[model samples]
Target chain A: MSEIIVNAVSKTWGGVGGVDRISFKAEAGTLLVLLGPSGCGKSTTLRLIAGLEEVDSGTITIGGRDVTHLSPAERRISMVFQSYALFPHLNVAENIIFGLKVRGVGRAERDEKLRKVADIVGLSHLLERKPSQLSGGQRQRVALGRAIIAEAAVCLMDEPLSNLDAKLRHEMRTEIRALQQRLGMTMVYVTHDQSEAMTMADRVILMRDGHIEQNGAPHELYNEPASDFAARFIGTPPMNIISWQDGAMLGVRPEHIFVAERNGVPATVRAVEYLGADSIILCDVKGETVSVRQTGYCSLPAGTQVGLEWQNRHIHLFDRDSGKRLADRAPA
Target chain B: MVAAVMTAAEPKTARHRNWATNVNAWLLLLPAIVLLGMFTHYPILATLYHSFFSLGRSGPAEFVGLENYRYMLDDDVFWQVLRNNFIFALATVPTSIGLALLMAVWVDKKIVGRSFLRLAFFTPTVLPMIAVANIWLFFYTPDYGLLDQFLKSLGFAGHNWLGDPSTVMTCLAVMVVWKEAGFFMIFYLAALQSIPPELKEAASVEGASRWYFFRRVTFPLLMPTTLFISINALINSFKLVDQLVIMTKGGPNNASSLLLYYIYEVAFNFWDTTYAATLTVTLITILAAVALTKFVYLDRRIHYQ
Candidate 1:
């Protein structure tokens, strides 16, 4: 019953459309990630759901209640900020129980919940330490702990792992996803990182320029992007968007493009970046930069001529003007 | 070992160079050290030395160790001035700091004419205390003054604002708070601005009321700034006697007289140098105690990152 329905919500901030008519429904006990590049209004949509921001037009409902006008506290929700936003003056234990204290939760219940949350977040020993004393990862755990302790139906996270280092981000990402599942809390996460969206989201709402480009599962967005922007944004190194005649563009994932000695489109290698697990070979095909992802070390020198081949179904066509995907693939 | 010892041994000129460096450092510090010695240390020690002596009338002075201390304890005016100073600090420091914090919060908001509001609040701080007291003197004037005229128009009688024994200290305290709160506000503004806006936003999401957020998060975070402003307000309460000189002159039974003003009166008006020196020692002790409290207690309680 904690399903959130954002109904055609639009929020214009500082003369720019923060989120324009963005509509999506996050089902109960699911992790829905609002993924997009910066300024794509993903965070704005999350804020609207939390009621931190009012919709310029349209409505938002949470847990079967029309909460478009309700303040964040009135709505049964918790949020973890990008900066963690831990109270620097309060110790870790106090920070986690702040919301409960504000709501006048009894001391016994608060302490009991605090102990359980601290054990889950691994912050039992650090209850006495202030936020300043905690490391970045530990601070992030505290933020997560604070949100989870609220026992709200929904937990909204705004790039909770972005402040951490790569290793910590990976660890926290797994921890957060696991925590969400264990608690069965409906969570709406916002981030620009596609890998995070692809790996963790039960459903990913990809946005661009204040509009939802596509809303589906991670692999659905990856395998069948709705437009050139969605196609390029959802994949690693992005889909290579090669322009064709008649205002059409061909989209292909880098991993799908296989490099052979001869048989397909002839291209010359411009550069090769060795990334241990896989090497990305940058090739120049008729002056358009095309990248090919190959397993293992690819030591081909610059100017090495190669043929790129892919299955007919792998190529995605889009209208160059509107950036919309075009069906019925034809020879480029 | 021979080579290590040979390398460790200093050259003849190296020792001379080290001595030269020491001499250069002292040369650079000479002016500052001399000024501090003559103006600060010498005066402090001299005041302590002088407090033990009796004022001489065209003759050599004699040592009167505890005589001045006993007189200070017995002098009703000195006791009244001391008590008034305590009351003045207690009345002004927290009130001004609280008002300063409120003004800072108001000005920090995106309100209309905020820059003008800030300027209006801070203008009193820029004006000389004597000029402010003179301006307020007209406002406090008994019958035809601004306050009295306003009160008369409001269907009430006007009382002597500055002349009344009961109201003199309170009037001065109010004026001092008005003149000083804005100056303290600048520090609060800087501290408040430095607090991340995201914290407030996060608090909003957590459903903390404005007052609750302020009590738990904002106020605790601003403890260092409050301590800083409190110390300044305390020191100013004792040192700022210009308005007392201009408005009340510690008159009408010495109700409004502070310690520093009384010291000035004893030293300059009565030519009791020894007594003034004793009073100066007391003022210094009070200020030193404040500085100690700040460094020892507040600093430990509020960790500044």
Candidate 2:
């Protein structure tokens, strides 16, 4: 396994910075995710570490070796693209063993590695079939097989499951986690999907506007965000950033808010979405929309008066001017 | 009971609708089928039929089975022209295709002045063949031509480019390749652009060298375009006799003459219609055979979908 250390790496295109001085360390045997919205430079950071995109200024060390100026091929890493990018002309086995053959490995060794990787990805029966004959999930497995067959210490995956259907994405996500754990591979995954970051990452670096807004574990990002942006971006139905008394912005997750009888600010229910296991209620509080997520079957009628309440510790106060968290605020 | 009654009544109306649809489809197809029959099928059959007859002067033509064929086999000029056509095809098709692929790759890459290079390469294709031949005639002129002047400046003796039998075919083949490669390059360029750029990035990340990526991924993916360009180049090689007429005129003892050019000389210049018809039949047969081999053999090996 390899520990990836990116130090103040910066890349710019035509005076517009794609990634501004960003630094993080993916510890050995940990799955680190670069999570952000589109155009937030998560993929750019992954590409920089893989040596696909040259860093304008900074040093990157993988396994303690400086690889900033090396070519992608010289870096000891493997990548799975978002599109799977399987060779259309090659069959499954050929696609998997292509890296080995190109490196001048012996045919016997290549075949042996191919079989092992195919078995791991459950693609043994499809070795002779072309990529055109495979389904979306099958093609994703082939891409994974290609990365795993190289046996690199650091594996980079750029939204590998973004092309698959929802059910298959869930299945493949779990399988990829299992595979990484079994092999002890240090992976740097890039995605805009926060759930993927939550369920798969040992550490998530949430970026915004070319800067790392917060870097911590998934639950830490969920419960304790560093800024208003992170507070609204990490969780499903996200956290509500409502103006508190004296113009302080308060951040609280939708799940933490309780529908009370008459203890707090009264709001009107705008809509209710009855998802099977969870129901989300949209409420209007002083012309600001706030969302409430509750466990199954919240059947409140529209335009009904409801009071919102939450524990004092759940309130995250932010400075109105800078959107940064207030240091002096304590739970009241 | 109601469903059974409806099903029984539906058959007659469905049959009537099917018949009406068939008639409408046939009406739409009539124009294309008729035009094709008049221009292509009729001419092919007429040429084959005329090959078996002899032209009689001042009298009705007489049937002569195999006579024209025997004469064609014995004619040295006909044999020479057929051999020359074969040589021209063998020289031009592969070289032009290779050059086209190379030029396409260079253009596809993000190089400086790429648009200008594309325009320069494709200029020869847009020029008419007769005009191109006229321009090349000046280049190949003995002693004072561009090629000879360059050679003379380099301390080498000047040689006859198109006049001598040894260098005539090679000069024509080179000119043909220069004209045709750019046209073929357009097809290759289109095919290359359709391949996702991610494949190249993945290959680079996988440690595949540029040449390895091209051989395993880019080249195989371009097979369908190559087949299409090759067929067009082959057909043009046989039919493109405009250059021969303008530059060589089948000169220096018909060294640069092609089969179609010879057929023109036989029918129009010498008034030998029967011999020309026999030669036309042979040309058609060769083209049909090539097309068949491509469909039956190459199509199986190069999967398009």
Candidate 3:
């Protein structure tokens, strides 16, 4: 019952640069991601839930307890910051058990917990090393160890993997997901990287301009975006959004479209991007740029004339003026 | 034969270039070396050399060879001033440092009129020591002084602050602390600013109270700055002589005098140049020992980022 319910939380500095009345719920034992670009107030929302920022209005609850006015510690939550914030002077072991010591836990219990957490984070051998001596990854582990050793029911992360390199980011992403599940902690992870949200989150809350643009499971957001913004924000190549007839926009995923010989929309092959597993053929339909994903190598040259087609079920229509998804399906 | 000769010439040219680089480096170092040797090294050596000699007030000076040292050991005024100097340091250093840290932490917060408060705290540091001493001297002046007048309003009797031996050292120490704490606060403020805000936020999230966070994290991280400020403060305690000259002048009975002021008195007023040189040598030895202990011991124990 460590579920967190953020009800209409709003925080702003002089009516600017903070979350609008954002509301969401993170169920117990589930990883919910708040995904957005910079300045979208994703971090602000997490900080609000963590009680680091006082909301201008509305209440936040943890496990049915209204913690809106409680301090960060009083909320009974742990957090991993983007910078990791390992104390430079304290060694790994001391850092892991710092919170326990702060709570006046016994020395023997602290040591036992330290050993277990050190092993879990794979920092047992490096316990005596100061943070300055550790590599970037190891320092991140120290921060993680510090956060998890508290055994708090709820944990919040603020773009924790943004500091790591690509390979390490991937590694930590999987490791963090596994650890979160193992501990059964209700976690709200914030990240600007949609791939991270898609890969690690049980539910993703996509934000825009301090408000939620869309909220759903990853596949739902990908397959059925609520608006044009959500369509272009997910997936690697993202969904192709082009102007359609009569004040509407047609949406199609890059993978859903295929090259057709005839009886389809007329387009020209603009370029080809060959990824290892698949090739993306860039095509110009009328005036809009559309990319069609093709398996294996795409031998189409830049100036080749081509026709693009997709199944009726793959096409999405949105009203041009509002950018909201149209309920009706397009003519097949 | 030509190839062999080409290889043979290379080492010689390389050696010549190396010699030129050495000379260039020395040329670059010339100005600083010249100034330090002329003003600092030469005076120290000259002081040490003169400490063993007689004043020769009546005739040519002669070698005294530790006579001034023996006389210093027996002089009551020397002992009194030395004791006063130590008492002055012990009283001023920690109090000023603590006050500076407190002021720095206060101003570091995002409070209303913060810049104004910082400027107010720093105003004392910008004043000349002579001006500061004169200002404090007026405050400590007997019945007509601001302190006594205020105390009188509180129904307390007027007391001589500087004229009395018992109160003079304490008065001077209070003035020095007031003048010096703001300058030290600048250093602590800078150190506090350099610490990442994330550390405090992290500690807060961990259920650590503000006091606990400061005690364990902020204070430990500030060790390097503390060590630096402490050493500077200690040396400053010994080096300060300007305020004493203006305020106490070694007092009615040499009660508030420091070693440097005593040396000044021996050298210029009494015309005891050799004994003054002896005192200067002792002062230099003490300062050197303090610096050496910091470098050899404290620096190793403290964490520097």
CAPRI band for model 2? high
Q: Give the whole-model CA lDDT for all candidates, comma-separated.
A: 0.92, 0.92, 0.93
lDDT for each residue of candidate 3 in A1-332, tens digit (9 for 90 to 100): 99999999889999899988888999999999999889999999999998889999999999999999999989989999999988889998998898899899999999999999999999999999999999889988998999999899999999999988999999999999999999999999999999999999999999999999999999999999999999999988999999888999999999999898886899999999999789999999888899999999989889888888889888899989989999856774
Candidate 3 has a TM-score of: 0.97
- Over 4 Å off, model 3: B1-9
Instruction: Compute the lDDT for candidate 1.
Output: 0.92
lDDT of 1 by residue, B17-74 (tens): 8999999999999999999999999999999999999888779988988899899999
User: Given candidate 2, what's the lDDT at residue B147?
Assistant: 91
Candidate 1 vs candidate 3: the TM-score winner is: 3
Query: Which portions of model 1 miss their true places by more than 4 Å?
Result: B1-31, B303-305
Q: Can you list the residue pairs that collide in candidate 2?
A: none
Provide DockQ values for all models, in the order shown. 0.77, 0.81, 0.82
DockQ, candidate no. 1: 0.77
Clashing pairs in 1: none
lDDT per residue, candidate 2, A173-232, as tens digits? 999999999999999999999999999999999999889999999989988888898998
Best by DockQ: 3
Worst 10 residues of 3 chain A by lDDT: A323-332
- Sorted on DockQ, highest at the top, how do the candidates line up? 3, 2, 1
Candidate 3 backbone overlaps, count = 0
